[model samples]
Target: MPARTSRMTLGRLLGLSRENNRARDWFFEDSGNLLPHHRHHELNPSIPPLEVTKIALRLRHLIEECVPCELEESLITQAHSRVITREVVLAAKEAGGEEYRSCVVFALLVCSRWFKRQAHLELWDATLHNVRSTACEVIAKAIIEGEEDMSYLLHTVLLHRFSILVNGKPTPPANAVEKAVDLHALRVICSSGYQKCLQYLWRGWLVQDEDDPTVFVDYRGRDDQRYIVHLDPDRLRAPVYQNIARLLFSFIYLALYTMSINSVNPNGEFDAAEILLFLFTLGFICDEFTKFWKAGYHILSFWSAFNGVLYAVLTVSFVCRMIGLSYPIGHELRHSYDSLSYNFLAFAAPMFWIRLLLYLDSFRFFGAMLVVLKVMMKESIIFFALLAVMVVGFLQAFIGLDLAEDLKTDEIWFIIQAMANSVMQSPEFDGFEKFAPPFGILLYYVFTFIVMVILLNILIALYGSAYSDIYENADDEYMALFAQKTMEFVRAPDENVYIAPFNLVEIGVIVLFSWWLPKRQYEFVNDVVMAILYSPLLLIAAYFESRKAGEIRRNRSRGEDDDDTVEEWEQIEDQIDFEAEGWTKRCAAVKANVETDPAVIEVRKLMDEVAELKLMIAELKKGMDGANGKKKDDVKKGSEGDGEDS
Candidate 1:
């Protein structure tokens, strides 16, 4: 189709009808728990050649219109019937567009409503896996793009559904059976969705080339072509880049620290700029430590060690500076103690290199090599430490021999050199037993062989094994890493403004002033001044970014090929069965939660009591019947006796 005609035709494919107009008033974003809002009105609008979109849109609207208490099974089934149909999915694949993708995702939320309907978890997961695994990219692309129509239609329905499941569980139930059913269903959906999301993440990452000239699906979703030109992160160009703001801030912190002490007062009293910069560095490092702790960093990761080491160095330097500052100028302690801070600061300069590598962690080769090195280092360090002690002992022993008579340095240095396979003129024991016995040379050679051949080979083996495991899981590991980074980058709402001094200023400006100001005035300042003043740089960048984004969308509308053929390596057939086990585990977990739920426990107790009461009532009725029969028998026997007497 020609560009003009494609626009003329597809543009008109959807328009604001009276039906959708009503839905526009109270549009629900991606929170699966629907609040009762204008429920008296309902609409089902359709755009042809894309029935899936229509179905998904209506279904989403339906979900928002009714809460779980009021949600009708018929409505759920109806929505699901439309979603399960091939019309939407096929439309998405054929059109190769976001709109079609959006429809399929919308349709998929029917699973949330139908959660109570499906009970057998493993079977349900298997069914969903087999059905949706192939279309992982389609679903992921929808999430990645995350485009909302002007009407606020097509939000992240699956994520919304997850929120609903998590929050809806603890509520007091109107019906225990219904609640249990829903709980089981929600758990199934959540578990299945997580596995499905992993597949989605994998499929999305599978196609990315990092070097793609056009664009790659990243968390920022900004046009990389324009954004890469000026990589001034935390400035105008920063927000447009994906997952680089914190990294950029780290570099900025390094720069501030380096520049702080370059020119100190001749009198040894640090200038105000120097003091200010040190304070900034201290604040930044503390924040980094806080973020590090909050992120739950493992000691096993090289970055964790790097961050910890940097923070420690900065802390020691800060303490020295503070101690020096405490003393009066021209005092002997001031200059002398201040130099200690400078000394530590100099040591920390090398850490900036490690920070750079950590920032570029998304690079595959860089990351893979780091993984290999980390494994090698972690495994060998302890062993080498022990070997160092033994080697020192041997060297001490060797120094006592006549062979060490010409040694210049300590025996420990010669031992270290020999063990490191370095050239050394000393420790030349010619014709054994010059000062020591022949047994000495024999022991030394034995130790050398063990250290050189055995330990070296062991270290090699450990590195090789670690590398192999990492290599085997390279794709999954990278995808998981990328996904986590992206999620973390976007997870915090304040990350945009949380850079050093600005964050401190925000406390006073936002917390103190806002409390003193009237509600309307404060909100006005927040909405207008603070938003614009702090973020205009981002806003301008966004405008230019949107222009580029518009071009990409136009290209997409013209039917550019976005779908990548599944490579042999990227095929997920093997993963589905593997995930099937995970799904089963999740099923067991959900079943356990449902069984142990307090509400269910109480319901069980009541039922048990009711059964006992019924049993007691039945026994009492049986006794009464027996008494009535005895009275009748007594009267009959008396009548017979009277007749006999007559």
Candidate 2:
């Protein structure tokens, strides 16, 4: 039989699993401690709260005893050299047993109640805040080293789960699991001087050096540096910059399409703008097709579905426009096709503007609103399902009544339309009364009451509930969106990124000829072509990055910190008592007072004395009772002996 599927694999606990490490040597190793390795059914919410707390405390104590090590020397050397080979990552598993065990304990501690409330801050201070040989350092170093699969590690560890199991399990959590970027992780990284470590990872993704293909280049200032310094944090390759450019392209293309429909004559020959718009439309259709193929069912999200409808309309309009252009200008068919094309294109206007919200979600308000809207839409499904059944039942009743009376006075379509209008608050009661007089009017009134007063209110309540849930966690929801947006660029990476209309050029020209070329030659050709095509963007990026670097250097020379400092004073502007002591000082004072107060000292001493006295009294009482019991037993035995002799 295959090895039994184990819960809480040692590799995962040690933070060296396949998801986080590219090395093949990273495999599942069970700790072999049965109690600590209990399955989901044995522990979790199934157990009593007190028992759970005791177990969690035991795990915390075990974790505290572990001594985690810093990044290995070989890993540091490889990082400095700008390339950490797979051998190094694999080698770690063979010889770094103690280090891996330490990581396991740290992981357990982080995923527990030990990392909550005041303990949360203390844990951070103990492990991540200027503590040497820390688990946090291991993670940070892994990210900075840019080896194996660090993306998963970064994404996984920073994610906060509402319902995490104390012990690992194959089954997912039964309760609703709410995951978001950890605010504590964000705060700690910003405040505890891990800024450069994060920057290294960000820059690794942003900067794509022309010379290096195998490794992410780290651009050091010195000329003697291992990697090239020219493209350190290349703004052109940055997702933020690329996404902005794409948005601008879309805006311009949409504008041109609108102008062509309104201003340009339908029968006129294609102008430069019209031709460019057509090319962009084709590019968009192709991009959509590619996304659908790669993403499969995942592409069926709300935004994607909206784009589907928008693109479908655009496609039909374009096809009609093309067919119309082919026909003679004065022909009847040509005129009809032109009108149809314009009408269809005009119908897509609202979609174009509505699509703007999807892209503008980088803003906090927009991001949070999108989440709320998504929740509302999901909740509306119940309302729609109920409405559908009611509509069917009511429509059948109206249709059957019309047929039964031969009152062919109203058509089936008319009755259907009237019912829809009633739902919209414009009921035609006059027509309903003409059908069965009293019964028809009564039924119509009942339906209206049920729909308007009951169903509609239920829908409103559902919407309110959905909105409240999203609103309560609005900040976390927005952070999750932000993290997702960042990960989008990290995941599903394209070796040669061809954005929109430029993709047409890449597909039509480069891809056609690249089939016969060697892999290396093909990559070289792609790089050269991309460089030539995006030279203007690259030039702009270089200028900005250079300016930013200069600003950093100047700040360093002036002995100013390069990091962003949280202005405590500025944040207190709204406070009424500007002269009042800060919370930090007050907290410190309270703690000091509790520790040093004379009355508190006296109380503690008295309590200790009382506890000792109670223990002594209990021991003395036990001794006296044992002696009395022995004497009673002896006397009873003597009496029994006398009776036996008689």
Candidate 3:
């Protein structure tokens, strides 16, 4: 017969088995002491057959209550004989229902914990390996089932065994139960079904403590107080503010660049091509500005303010153009000319270039405003110079024609006229007629010559200096060249054609003068001239201020010392009067008063004396003190000092 059947038959046949069954009932009744080996095995092994039957019945009852399945029954019997294996547990899991499988798994955990008490090495090793493997597989399945709270179950079963294998042994099983649990967690993280599980693990599981460095709080729904991850506020704020500024600046630049291009003809229809280009360019600028803003620059505010005005002008100009109306200069042309007389005023009124310059110098409000005015005037000056040259050439031609026809002289007046016209018609003179001239015909040539030679040259130089300052690195040098080329491309009448060699030559001259000239020298020259004119007055004022400050400090120190001395004297007098009234007071107090009072008077007198004698005495005393210290140090050095002295 099978071992289980034999045991049952034995129990049924004996009357004494009834008493054994009662003892077994007592043994298996409570869960409190059921797990420990001592409680289960404490009964005498040499007892009657009735007692043995009773123990067997008690063991069977405990197994039924705790283990809950046929597999656990087989495991408990096999465990006693050291025959149970991981494969047997797995087979049980495969055969049983979900509840049975859970029960079997739990029974294996209890058995493994019980086996830890056994001295038999082989039994212990086999039980530990089997339990760990089975636990790993079961936990992996639980994880796959999309269970959110499997981590705790995993830790309770296989995590400890896995950690032991990792820490204590070198050759842990290749297909260990711990690895299966990890694989399951990884699979869950990758799956859409367990996204919340993965998030919980990421946010909650890996949190570090602020106070206790070594302690880790396990995941539990209860108030098991734990640390949380926090982002640095300053780090978060920097990028946000930077991006805002960048966006504002970019918008402003786009508005200004577009408006300036469009405002050439007030009554003309808005160019669809330019408008599209403007939008596209604005988009690109916005993208670049976003990058700059994200990097944490504060220059965007100036650009924003500038762009606001430029956008307003553009809106008004676009409205006027769409309505087939000119932007109102004034009631009369003369008044309009008068209003736009100063080159600085004209550039500032347009708003585009002025705003761009201001945006570029965002850190300094006043400085940015000045830069805008300067840049606007500089660009205007270049155009005016070109215009002046054209006018001069036109006049020379007219004069040449008149002389050739009216004088009836063999003058090369026609050649002069041709030369003047050639100069006027040069590509450099493209935008000269935009600014209306007052004494049109007569002053045109003279003005043109001055504009070309002086104003244009100055503008070129200014641009070169600005570019050099902005781009200090070798890479920046390349970028500066690229920017210059781009500007040339934009300025060219036909997009297809390259800038002419003559224009390049002119630009080169401007760049050379602007960049190579010693700016500091010029500044120094101006400073020297100003110093020569007003430095004496500045020196006088500075001297007066310094003297006043010194006097105030002196008076303060004197007053403080005087008050302290008066207080000291009053205290000494009160102490003396008290002492005279009481014989218990020391006569040394009176002596101290006399000595301290004289010394104090002497110190005050010394302070009042600002003569060289006190300084000499102080110097002599310092020297003597230093000498005495050196002698004392020498005496301490004994033999070395004596040798040095000899």
Q: Which numbered prediction scores highest in TM-score against the true structure?
A: 2
For residues 1-646, write the lDDT of model 2, one tens digit per residue: 1111112212232344545532322221121111111222211113232332343344344323332332343432332221233443333222214322212212333433243443446664543222222222233334323433332223222221112344543223111101112223322233222333244333432232344221223333311111122332233345665666677777987787778767656574677776787788888788878777876776568887888898889889889888988889799888888888888878988888888787788788999999899889999999889989989998888777877788564668878888898788778887777877777778888888878888889999999999998898787667556555654553344566677777897896565767788765565556556656665665565555555555544544544433333378756666655347586666666774432447778898999999999999999999999999999999999999999999
List lDDT for all candidates, in order: 0.46, 0.54, 0.36
Residue 532 displacement in candidate 3 (angstroms): 64
- Taking every candidate in turn, the Cα RMSD to the unseen true structure, in Å, is 21.7, 17.5, 44.2
Clashes of each: 1, 0, 9
Q: 2 or 3, which is superior by TM-score?
A: 2
Q: Superposing every Cα of model 3 onto the true structure, what RMSD results?
A: 44.2
The best-first sequence of candidates by lDDT reads 2, 1, 3
lDDT of 2 at 201: 36
lDDT of 2: 0.54
Give per-residue CA lDDT, model 1, range 505-544, as digits (tens).
5555677667689854554343343334445344455456
TM-score-better candidate, 1 vs 2: 2
- For candidate 3, the 10 contiguous residues with the lowest summed lDDT are 226-235
| Candidate 3 runs further than 4 Å off | 1-236, 239-241, 244-305, 314-442, 469-646
